[model samples]
Target chain A: MGEFHFYTKLDQTLLLGVKAGNAEELLAGIQIVPDSSIYHHTHRYLHQHHYLSPEPPNDFAYWTAHVLGDVVLGERLWSVDIVGFQSIAELRQTFVNILEGHLASTRRRIDCAGGQEFHFMASRTYVLPTPHVAHNLAEFAHILNKVSINSLYFHVFDAKLRLERGENDFSRWFRSLGKTELAEKSSRLDPYSHTLDGLRREIIAMVEKHGSD
Target chain B: MARIEDYASFVGQATIDELFLLARHLEGKSVQNVNSTAVGGGVAEILSRMIPLLKQLGVEARWDCIKGDEKFFATTKKFHNGLHGVAVDVGDDEYEHFLEVNRRNAGEMTFGDIVFVHDPQPVALIENRAEIGRRWLWRCHIDFSRPDPKIWKFLDQFVARYDAAVFSAPAFAQKLSVPQVLIAPSIDPLSDKNKELSEEAIASVFERFGIDRSRPIVTQISRFDYLKDPLGVIQAYKLAKQRLDMQLVLAGGGATDDPEGPAIMEQVKEQASKDADIFVLFLPPASDIEINALQRGSTVILQKSLKEGFGLTVAEALWKAKPTIAGAVGGIPLQIAHKYSGILTHSIEGTAQWIKQLISSPAYASKLGENGREHVRNNFLITRHIKDYLLLFISLFHEGDIVYL
Candidate 1:
């Protein structure tokens, strides 16, 4: 596993919002581009993914209100009626609209500082491959080679992505993704192993094999 | 031998004879109870009374406690809270340490024909059951209605290995393959805590504690644990005191295995110190008679637990013919019949309202207490507990057979 650092731009932004002690800035940063950072993407993904028969509201509102010290905004965000939204995308849009309205109306705002340094430091930490990058076996293999992996969280994301696309075995899909050696190695991978470095090494070896081929 | 016939007066001759008949079936079977503490908490208190009674009834029963360091206890305390549906910090290290302690205890601990492992503390002891060749029963004394899924899943692995699981209330039971038995924990009426004390003894207890008996007394007797919500009790008392003059007694002791007791007790003391009427008595471990006296002296007994295993204090107060106002959680409902025997409250506001009602209407309070005592006598006494265990032990051996009493 890599050091406890923020690997995504969204994490850096959220950390800034957390440090700024501003809920408006945090919500602004979180909903910036919808899919900008893993944090933003994951929330959007989870929201969209479970949209029809979605689970209860995630901790976005709680983090916004409690951790970021914006009770008014948090309560407003939490009070958003998600009953009629048919998809996670629709829910995310509604949530963003509510958050934006709150942000515009609220007079309180914290001046966010030290973004560059925070970004530089966070770049060194491990972050899971984005859901988009992990959409397929080939893209997943490619992303795994470039970034540090958080194995447990990544596995869940990968499993869900695979289940959505009708793929189960990484090796079998790697064969279809045209990385046969990687697929062979993927079949032998211990899914239960929590070590990121071991998984990183396995991915690197498979990538090396693909490069040689 | 503390003969079954000795309990004739409290439980009646027929009940004793029925228990004796059940005990005869398991006359020579070895029954051992393994818990986390030997004193302090209800599990230890129950085992201390229960083991001897089991022995007297001719079931070769013994009690054993698991050995653990401060760290292990801290983890187990978190586990206890987690099992009660409280959000607790039970990380990987805490989990490993808990299992390591259990594994160590599992190696050294001996068993009986039927090993009764009480609560989550010593639950993993069933790992050694296969080798030891003993029928293990996991006796869960806490509410497991909505346990932290991670902790519950971890404990469930060990629980599934048991021959059967015992819960204090039907609501506390989870769906498991093993036969689940609802065995409500009981208070020994003959014990110092539940036994009738003379007016002088009761008055002396009030005098020692500097409690003013002139005003109505509201007492909550429980261990100094967050789950007991001692702070909430003080808040309820303050609310009630706004309308009526009452002296609140928060009397309890610490459990050896619960490391959080001292910290929680300090918080209780601070909250209680705001009002001079609220007396915080950190009673010593063996101060059962004092506890009994405090209950006897009280106008209304409060057990405002945020979460409860069984809240034996409710039964203890009810047995003494005192109207109890307790939280509507866990096994408290089984003891209290809501206005019929005792009142069950959901919040501090509700508790305060009931406290005021009970204190104002002395006639109604006395009636409730009378009903409560009968309710306890019919159900919550230790004689019924012993009979349940004997029946449970017999059921373990005779698996499919319907053992009629």
Candidate 2:
């Protein structure tokens, strides 16, 4: 009811991860802003990008505000594709790279110890551009299951997307060992004007609708 | 009339002044708290009281909760039981459900300068520290001295992410690599529930509840959860009733997240139905004054919890200078100083024995009540808690900033 205070800087731990390369740059940028100033700037930024409009209808404004302020939405920023890797070797290498860059050597060692125990199956498919990321995620999960690591995982896609798509056809298919629709769409659209251009149009339209709603 | 300063005599003005000074020192510091529910539990109650006081003191303190669905709550209830050394079925779906809720809550709430995530229910909110800059502190109110390995490992990941962790008792602390602090929970002596009641006020409350002033009353006011052991309280009262002319009052309400509460309450009602003297009260959330009246009107108070997270109600009864017998678990030890302040027992038999002794011996009960009020004044009052939090907020900013002023 009072004035909504937007945090100026990105969260410190999130910033630390970004500095280490565990997270993205754009996200880490918000760590330094004042709390109230963040909302003002982000609202303006989203408006310019057509993610929102200044004078959208009440419903559009409400949902737009909700999405912007929601911490759940921001969680997808550094989302690694758990199912994207081809092999345990690939997963190991990517983790090694992350540890060498984004985390301390000691932390990386811990991550590796935990990573080795993880086993992602084609069974735990999630809604993303690829299915393999889910498999890759299984590595960390396996480690978590085996080891005594008391860590918190957001599982952003697992929590929000899985529920939205429903437990039927799409979710069941995603949980299977097959490929996902988004990845296929992107691949098909990669070479053609229809897929990329059509996606662009959709994003623009969604942003417009969100802005003015 | 019941402003914060009204508690000065009990908590000491010098102590209150020092807390204000500490809060002022941390005026620019940002702090946050994360817990399960914002309304039903003790953490929420304390935060609701503490946050406003923090703002009044000029330090910015925020509160947040970890989001969970019905399935997530069910899993976490198992996690809670397991943390207290109860074995339950916790498979992959349970773990996934738990993570799903944390992810949802983490996405919805805002982070502060320093984050204080309370209990296991919302521990996952710390995962965002990789993106947020404020210092994060994990506050554990539950006893985890002998937690189940399966559940503890799942929680350890998030606990390790924070800068520091706080526990209520020494026994409850685990072997964490991070720095840990010990700060016991406290009650507001100036609050309506804890303030002294007049003869007329006490009498009116007893009359309204249909409690005869002639008969000695024994009451236990807490949530209708098994951990609080309301049915066990009834059993203890029944045992004590065989020797003395007394009435038993089991007054408690339900929490939103605790789905098993209604079933537990039904069981308690069934147990209490054998005797007419057993008064089973299902009080609403806004029944704080009624609770105050019940505690005040009672000859003795009981908090026979099997597991507890600092029974503030015990402290509330003790603050009113009522002789109380409580189970020695969680934060109960901090409030009761054995025979000095109040009595602490483990089993229903021990609770019954203490109740019988206190009810039969009026002089001893009065002596214990006198000692208990001073105990609350010296340690468990809200002013002391405010000081502890203010100092915590100040510690986040400076490594060597100390002032005699």
Candidate 3:
């Protein structure tokens, strides 16, 4: 197998020039804001507040709950199982389904203040290759501990959640190296429950544990 | 002197290495930062620090100023206020003068591979973009949430011509055709204003400013501008002083011919009285070390702004691990996440209560300070800012890079 080349990412968020002051507009935006916009609203807080534990709420859920004053819908949207989605397209469709169901059952359109309106944004990320390459698990464990949180974020969260990769780069790479136990354990690790820093530590610990065994 | 490597200890060696790696793609590309002034205000202060650092990282970066007469500057100042949604009347001649100044500067100046224009003052330089044919980027440093319609309309034409626009916050993004990138301004942790100070340095400021070192101190360091609401801070201090025995020191820069500054100072004095505890010291604009000392020595820091842009003072205070209270406006909320990192207040009453509460609860205040420092350390430091900018410059070239949520 080729050496696992580490990569870090920096996102430059761009306004989509479309915003939603009301639930209808928000639903419409969700349906057609390109996959990147869908990916952005769901995952921005993860990168922004990477220190917060148990993960922070996504922008859509926050807006519905706080801005639109629909706490039930907010909770419902927040409780959406991100792990079940195969791709951002599926995730986007899931949001649409939830919003459509709410609008259908209640048939009430809620509008927020101008300042509180949801401005759909598309992130233009620069995924640059870093200097950390590991040909083996020991080298990978050593290099993974020191890579920036952005590198860890790209591998774990962005890979599985945004890129539609069924498993994270680490898990897939471990499996390619015939490390089945390591792959399963790494893939089983949930990213939403921990900050990127915390997630990095977790992955490091998992790799070291496997080595010791 | 301020090498990118200097940030290794503060932001880890990997973070600094990432900056070099990002800068590799832009091998021989040059970035020219053009603004109205060479010094003063946030744009200049940032460029003064950022230019050298960019060059040190092997990107050919230089800063240029658009020369303007008093009329031009005055018109631009009104445009600035208008961009912040302030009510300012500007005439046709004023707009024409602004264009003439920019046109002249464009003619005289040499354009780099990427011509970076900062704020509304030099945005009109894009008129010559077709002739010069360089990658043009407009960077808006102010909040555009409620910009005046006329001002926005006038500037929208020039803004639309840019290859891309950069804003300090997502709220600042408008419905422009250009791709708008959100890049927040940063504070240099190693700068005189934000660096670590000795115990004696903190003590010397209190002695020099006549602030009693025995009692706990409450501070709000900003200009005496009406938007900053210096009087509102004084009112909050009075409200909190009902029970707390703390000294309030309102320190900021002075030496401006603007009549409003002295008038506000007078109002702040009248509200606080000749009370020794209410020391309003107007230090020189370059007194970063003094400001750092004052922030470090304070018990609780308040930004208490009626309106603000980014509010780096709050970040400075937080970096010192001091519990802070700031108005939940502009980019302040991004710095203070409600009660977690620091307290965000809406009214003078709330500010007063937070002030009193934070002073009384030492353990809670300490935790908030630690959290606030961590927040700033993760997001607002200069190294991360430079890396973001480098990525931004690279993005201008490789517009095809995909997304990550």
Candidate 4:
């Protein structure tokens, strides 16, 4: 596993994504570099953890891995920047390339605002690496069968993928990702992510384990 | 002194005197208004004018918002659909989301001596009755004669607990165990929308927008929500334009709680693009004076909402004596008395028919405007609204085991 690092974005330049416990304090203490822009924005203030800023003259995987890598693997970070590309097709291409070999994983933590919080985790984050993602839903299901579904967060950073976030309930589909391998294999075949036969069987087993409704 | 009077003169002396008379009875009582958003919608717009007027009248009235996130607002948006009789397949989680936001608001907001909770957004705040001994009223601003059962069941639990539930129209009221009052929402005749604009102000607005005063302008001012039906307004205008060479201005903005507005605006644009006579405006929330000038500059005003709580814009345009043709829904019927005051139409075809009638027959349109202004003055002015509220608040103080309508 590669060791994680952080970097901050000042204007167009990536400084370092710092891993300080208090993002507010880290932002206040950091001084602006001379001849550099005095970057002042709420997004910069709110975003504390930065994993890696891909060097320029990079491909889609660099931007995709740079953006999704931290959000998928990292905990305690509010946002992950994919860094913009000339077109979304290029970004999708990068996501496909990264999901080819490595199965990424991250431990779970609670995300809270005000006084309310909930636990979430992403065990595996990957891309389909195939064409016609939506129309060919069966092929995508085949890929889901191979990967361990125990991950909390899974994202395919495409406009088509963005629509599914609304179509599928985040909390319910997220829990379905934590199923056993046999159940996960079966769930991949189910049309709906939340209501697959395999996902149901896994949920039944989970409720039994936790002794819940 | 002239400037002070100029601003103050908007609400005429007669209206101010009437407010003072009503204010003396309920001088020290703490009145709290609870609603969805402090910006955008008509309820909030009325409160913005009314709260300050109430304070000036020596009443301690304050406004509070029900806390909600994007997900919760989505649920409330569903509730709005259901309340207005739209068929929506809202799930159990959506109901839970509504309650969750209400709980947050109930925990945060201070319940006053007279808590006037407005609309379905904060209706569930009445659940905090054990902590509050004062009057709690649920003010329903939408037409709810045929609300979806799924939403009504969830809202009924909260509304049944209220001391009283006030609806805009008699038809809007449900058969509840508690007393029901019909207090229609009013427009501030002195607000920016109805205030007298100088010729210079009107000309400047026209010049900035490249609108020529030489041609007659047909305008519809509303938020770009589906219920307002901006696309229908454009279609009606095109139908009316075949006879008269007039320009159409569809000017509106969106509300924070209404996420579907931008898409609706896009649809309106797609439809408006077919005709060069049509101008679709995506105005910001603070363009009140701009709206005033638009209304003043126009020859005919239309508010063709498919479903409305009470179309304050109709009263606003009517108060300015601009002949309006509004849809006959919600509280619009109360404002538009057919041929006497303003014209009310049921369909887009009917709206087009009336628009042509008003445009060609200037004498008839002038007479309608003359009557419309008097109708607003007699029934729908803010003075009348403030008086009704004072009386309603006073009625809440009476001790009775159960008060009957």
Candidate 5:
């Protein structure tokens, strides 16, 4: 195997100028927004509150439930297994379906206040390389303990979900290194269920135990 | 005097190293920051601190301010008020003068790889963008929720000339040709206003201001401006005091660009009345340590602004683990999660109710304070701010829409 270089992501959020005061409007914006916007609405909280446990709800569910006061629709939106989708298109479709279904079934119309309107936003990301590189399994586990949560998030959540890499950057790199056990353990982990800090701790533990084996 | 590494103690050494790594990506590009003032205001204060740190991190950064006469400044102040949804009649000459001042400033200034212009004061500088091919970003630092259509329409034309427009809050943005990015403002945790104060310092500051520490203190620290609703803060305090015995402290100073500070202060003083419990302190710009002591000494802090960019005072109070009650307008919601971190209020009644509720429940207020501090540390620190700005600068160079990791 060769050296595995880690990269981190920094995001700049750009407003799309498209806003929604009600569920129908929100659905329309969701349909037309770019893939980055879809990704942003889903993973926004994951990045912002990376230290909190039992990962916070996505912007869509939180706004609808808390702001819009549509508890049932909020539950439906929240229940969408984000990690189950292979691409942003699929994840976006799931939201579109849920919102469309709710708007059709429920005759209740809810409009947030003037400032409470949900602003459609997208992120322009800059992927930069970090100083950490691992030539072997021992080096990789040691470096994992020191890398920033952003680097860990880049390798885990960003690589797995946004890039549609079939697997996270760590598992893919591990597969290349012929460490099938470490790769499988990492591949089995879900990135959104826990905080990024929690995710890093779990991965570090998996890597360390694999090294001992 | 504080180095980039001095922040390592607050946000760890790894976070400091990440800044160095990010700066490496901008090795070749020079960043030039232009605003209206070099001191006093938030933009100037932020740049004065950030430019030196950027240079220390190996990025060539410089700052300059536009030279404007009293007429120009007064007109810009009108523009400022107009942008905050205030009605002000702006004549054609005022418009022409705004452009003339921008033209003079733009002609005299040298461009960098990236020219970052802050607020509406220097927005028209983008008119010269075609002559000089470089990335230009217009960062609006006002409560742009509801601007006067006349002023906004006039400024929108010049603003569209920029590569991207950045606002402090999501609601502040409008539909425009350029991409409107959202970047919340931040406070330096190590700065005088936000730094830790000793018990003696807090006590002395309280004594010097004649505020009795024996009783609970309810305070609002902000520029005594109309938009800040200092008079409303006094009313809320008076209402809350009807039920609970507490001291009200309203402390703030004026910015170099703003001329209405003394007038607003007078209004606040008259509203506060002769009640010794109601203390109105007009502080100097260099009184950050005293401000920190005052914030630390307060039992509950209030930022009942009718309009705000980000309500940075909320962040400052929350950073000190002081339970806060602020208007839900603008960026206050970002800092407070409604009874979770701090309380968000809509009117004078709501603000007063929350003040009473927070003071009545010590355990709940303490919990809110803890959550508020954690929230500020995670999202609103200078490290996160520098990272965001670095990302924004780097994205200007990249051509395509950056969706995939």
Candidate 6:
């Protein structure tokens, strides 16, 4: 089964909140991180693989309405003014409740008995790399601070998407910014030869080594 | 230096005086033209004539050619076809190669007061304009009304960065963010290709090509490109020959950058070999006097193009007072006023019909030829072309500045 990769900052923040069992820390993580940096990679990955969620997101309401394909649910989600929540825990709970409500209301089943019984098949589950490899919170913090590497990884990721679709706009624009080596490497990248998880692991290792230096 | 007054006899003193007035406005500004080729194509032909004339009018003008290898040119040739609405497979690799070549050329290029980049070959040079700091103008000499969506989208980015864009016809203009100027291409009346030739010289050309002077001759002069529809011209000639006894001359040569010419020439030769009435003469470059003789010797001229930039041959033929029948595509319609100056045809059958009618009715053919010559004299001459360019250069400094002439 193919694995899905998360942005290092997002992964680090989620790991910290889960370990500490603190929803407030998770909310702090979401707020502190620039939304575009996280969202741009997700949107590009989904769009490139032709796995886009119906109406692709341009903003919060559109993203919810189109991606989730539920206008009323999207309106309810939009009603929670992201900035108005007094605590990160409250914001976290609101998101969790809306998702749980959507799952409960939209559940479906099929009966397949006509004298003969058939076995139901389960689809392969997506996996994410464990974030515990970093020894401590300090190591995790150091990794997250390497935002320049995140930006580099974004170029590498975006370039692969463009190459797969036989487009060079991103790479050309990348070169125009005086990033010739990065642009050249991006054009030469073969997406099939390297998986997203594999690239993420390599970037994490590089960031950890750089922190040691 | 050929002065502006040299064209007075052909275009009149009033036009010459007007051009001089406009040239005075462009006094010290230097104009640099960038294109892909130095020979063979209309862009090179026009620049060769225009630059010297621009100098004579006291407007400093220079020309440069962008360097590219075979693969780069092969890719750009596809771009040329794609821009003309022809389906071509231009993927990421092609785009990469195109940009790589442009990047190399961009490193060597230095701009002037007015940098005129021609066609798609050197269009990407505008990417360096921020550092160079010059007013850049992109002159599109091809029909770009409908272009490949992907290619057009990519080119549009560079085009948007330019100060202004120039097109040969109003129909060729796209909805560009920058201002667009419509200036039709012109033929040099004093050049070897359009200069007056003696009957002896015309007869010698016929003898050289072994063309039978006894039979009425119909000719189409253009490069052997599929867009020119040379095979379709042969079909039209065959159809016309069914009703009347006549000879056909398909005379043209290839440009260096156009790799499709030899293959298209082979296809044209194979099509023409079916009959002896047709003469497929592949003239060498700079055979202007020979081209002039061929146009003058023709009873009727045909330019049956599927798509054209400006079809300068139509203007060249009309200037010779030949009853020209050109395809009703691209900038051909701008020159031919349909049943007035010359005829415009849409298909092989239509071209055949016009050729047959013009051959049979000498009086009507002669009248059309007379009207066509006058039209070219008043509009499509080099004198007017120089005036238009001078005014364009002057207008760049003064936006919303209208010149009353």
Question: Pick by TM-score: which candidate is best?
Answer: 3
Model 1 stretches astray by more than 4 angstroms: A1-213, B1-3, B36-40, B66-78, B86-110, B128-131, B223-235, B254-276, B399-402
**Please, what are the lDDT tens digits per residue for candidate 3 over residues A34-110?**
88888888888677777776554788887787567888989988998776677988888888999888888996777
- The recovered share of true contacts, given per candidate in order, is 0.00, 0.00, 0.49, 0.00, 0.65, 0.00
lDDT of 5 by residue, A94-124 (tens): 9999998888897989998778888889877
Q: Please write out the lDDT profile of model 5 over residues B16-104, one tens digit for every residue.
A: 88788878878889999899998777788888888888899898889888999887888898999898877899999989999999999
Candidate 6, superposed: residue stretches over 4 Å from native: A1-213, B1-3, B67-75, B89-109, B224-226, B254-275
Model 5 lDDT, residue B37, Cα:
93
Give the runs in model 4 whose Cα sits over 4 Å from its true position.
Answer: A1-213, B1-15, B36-40, B66-74, B87-110, B128-131, B224-226, B254-274, B398-405
Q: Write the per-residue lDDT of candidate 4 for residues B205-318, one digit (tens) a residue.
A: 978887778988999998888888887888888888888888988887763446677787778888778877687777887798999999988999999998777778898898
| TM-score of candidate 1 relative to the true fold | 0.59
Interface RMSD of 2: 26.4
Ranking by TM-score: 3, 5, 6, 1, 2, 4
Off by over 4 Å in 2: A1-213, B1-3, B35-37, B64-78, B86-111, B128-131, B223-235, B254-271, B347-349, B397-405
DockQ of 2: 0.01
Residue B258, model 1: lDDT of 58
Output the lDDT of residue B340, model 6.
68
DockQ of prediction 4: 0.00
TM-scores for candidates 1 onward, in order:
0.59, 0.58, 0.92, 0.58, 0.91, 0.60
Clashing pairs in 3: none
What are the chain A TM-scores for all the models, listed individually? 0.33, 0.17, 0.95, 0.19, 0.96, 0.24
Every model's DockQ, to 2 decimals? 0.01, 0.01, 0.47, 0.00, 0.53, 0.01
The docking quality of candidate 1, as DockQ, is: 0.01
Q: For model 6, which pairs clash?
A: none
Which candidate do you rate higher for lDDT, 1 or 3? 3
- In candidate 3, what are the lDDT values of residues B86-161, reduced to their tens digit? 7889999988888998898888998999988998999998897767898888888888878899989999999999
